[model samples]
Target: MTMSLPQQAPSPQHCLIGPLPQLFHGELAAYGAALAVADTSAPVGTALEAFLDGPQLAAALALFALRFPGAHPKALASTWSKLYFNALLVPVLAASSACGWCFPLAPGRVRFLADTDGAPLRFVLEDAGAAHPALDSAARLQPLVRNHLTLVVDALATQYRLAPRLLWNNAAVIAEETLLQCQLLMGAQPRIAADLHFLCATAQWPDQLANPLHQPTRLVANVRQRQLCCLRYRLRLDFCADCPLDCRQRQAAQRKLA
Candidate 1:
């Protein structure tokens, strides 16, 4: 959704990337203690506010930026959440499916970050190579993947009391953003070896989503329409790359003289 995102200089001396497990090779306990204070019982806004009391939020934001380096956050809570969810669900699910597990995600259980400014700067699922509880059977993989992804998104939406369509819209955006990236990755020479290619794999779609919510909640639903406008154009002079044009929907009073 960010156009012309400002490039933050990567601190080669500080950034790190690797199998999340190896990255936190021996530090899970300390990491858990740091996030223990987040107020999960409060209202959405209150919870997010309390959860951010320490450096946890900043660290999480840093993790969110790992996929697309130098990505900056917007003031909108939705924006922050969308980025965070993309970081958590997209890559994590793809990574899990790449292997044979259904690694559950949470603010705590899944790998979070202390910092990402060091050597080896791409965060990946080192655990993906291993198998876990799920059957990974063709009939079950879609629900497995969908439920895992929906679990995190649902919890976040409920925790933050976000709007009804927030998670759905976010899911839409993630699908589009991911497929676009994969298309580029597909064109790489010698074939880039990556686990994140599932986003664009047709074999991954038909069963990716568990329910047929929305007009069509298939893995990459409505790819034909591309993207629904972020609706920002309704209030300002800006439109996102996939924002659907609806100039006709504008009030006659606000019509321009073009």
Candidate 2:
């Protein structure tokens, strides 16, 4: 069984916490994400590379299958990526813009925490110490995409027989949404706002490869729409309100009800 984590504890000395406690309070806390300190109370958990390897990925897929009965492998993969990005990106990007800190997300330094069912819960990672110096959007984002997310996306795509674009879309949507929220909250700080804007608006990283995150959504008519469907409806969930595949009429109706 997954033991309940101890009541909220003080962040470890080297964990990323610059302005996080204040930024994540009150109603905004619902959107907050953080890295858990590595401690005995939490299980040692699987290393990030283990997900790319055979055993841990298989176990995680089995648990996801059990968790979302009738989900196709595609939907299952999407679900996993959504959770993964939420746990990692929301906090990391927020800290980067809000406090000028960047996390060292190398696979070796990061671990994934899961419940008894092997469902991912959070990550345990250490801060990389000082922040990078005035990096452009491409340089600032390169390590995050290439060093960390790309490996995970490649693994999931190969394992699930899903397209890499779909997985990238999953991450892109989360990143786009996170940056938008950060802008709303940190708009008063020009650098923070600019960082958020450059991260969102730039199409390619330093490598000049087509950025999957580059405008993953668009303003369709008046309503915004996702560039690609996440395929979750295959699992029997409703099409995301912004899904491009869903007709504009249905989207309008849903918005009215909201």
Candidate 3:
């Protein structure tokens, strides 16, 4: 008589009953991304536009200045922008690429919460119920890039007297890093590659307008080099390892190795 093999169990599937999937819990918490809760001890957050327009921006910068004494105001704002992008983009990009879900991440719908130390505590979305499937990069991130982030970038660039390209470069780094982490965790999700290309490789957005995030970095001898300097060196007194301004030595070293 022939022996029969046992049947294998079905692979687990993700269902979006709430703001995030179980797979994303650790990643979201690491980035301080959270859904709004009724009993949160976190302070009430300001709408993104109001935060940019009101005294909230000044207060935030003041807190950042206190935290990093002697740093120039522009450098303070640039560093704060990096923190803000990290809190906002990591979860949004992870959810979008891994699960095909898009949060209504317009500035008005999002809020920034702060800890007692006045650092970013959480990025809260008011309505995760409005999420929908987005199969392409534009469908996933247009409102986020065009409506929310672009407005904030322009405001910060004007206020700080910094280059808008540098601010966009900061955002591009955050987006690229977030997608890289997601791919590492979930394997090669095609959407991640497509989104990365749309954000970094293409010079135009899906609408054919200029893509502010396009070609934010270049790869030389397998070493990634940023196209624009973020000026964090002003704060930290050292250039980032992959910084374009500081990459010549790294490139030379890599060339020797090859």
Candidate 4:
């Protein structure tokens, strides 16, 4: 069974806490048109445009962000971009490609990866059982997962000028714990968020660095094409597509079963 999300919508006071939705809608529409041109047999563009204009994309992104705090903002944006483009955009562009494009017809599982530097990335696919062994140890992995997510959320709050009141209570302590956990899991001494920021800015592919506290980051994953495309971000980690960490446990279970 699929996991159920909390039914409560964002309070009116919290509505403006993250990135705006218009940015994603416009990008997805453009991407859909591009896909349509490639597939001569379908009117995928029109369908994709309509889907993007609907509420599904917004809802999906919001839910994913709320669910997975560990996902890098860039990764979340890329994941969402791919989902919107392929599942909703491409299909509407070329229905025949639906089978090929929709590797994850339903919400897939998510996994979080953090290097010694504290840069976090999320991996998502239909099954987690097929994932690397390091991803499967629930007892050992759960704390790290939680810590990564808390840090992302904290970083996002700092970047966006979002008030602490908008986040869950006790966010700072939670974030600190997360940082510690990431340090433990990676077997590296933890650096202060400020120090990590310096490292991220100098990195060759800074976008791959998960530092929502500094500026927005972008990442791309081509599940079928094996390409990595960058997605745009407004608020540091505001987009939902990049929040693969939210789906990690579920993906792990699914992959284990498979």
Model 2 lDDT tens row, 1-258? 001222243334323354556666543443333465455555456677875675787677788788777667788878777777776787777777766666668787787765456555666665433466476555566678777988888888888888898888778777877777777766767656666555556776556776666677889889878888887666766777778875685566457435
Residues 215-234, candidate 1: write the lDDT tens digits.
21222444333233333433
What TM-score, over all chains together, does every model reach?
0.45, 0.81, 0.80, 0.20
Model 2 regions more than 4 Å off? 1-16, 26-33, 39-43, 131-133, 248-258
Model 2 accuracy (lDDT, Cα): 0.67
Badly placed stretches (over 4 Å) of model 1 are 1-75, 89-108, 111-148, 159-163, 187-209, 212-229, 234-237, 250-258
RMSD of every candidate to native, in Å, equals: 10.7, 5.7, 10.5, 20.9
- In what order do the candidates fall by lDDT, top score first? 3, 2, 1, 4
Better of 2 and 4 by TM-score: 2
Candidate 4 residue-wise lDDT, 225-258, digit = tens: 1111232222232323423333564455346434
Determine the backbone clash count of candidate 1: 11
lDDT of 1: 0.37
Candidate 3, residue 65: CA error in Å?
1.1
Candidate lDDT scores, in order, read 0.37, 0.67, 0.68, 0.29
Error of 2 at 179 (Å): 0.9
Q: How many pairs collide in each candidate, listed in order?
A: 11, 0, 0, 17
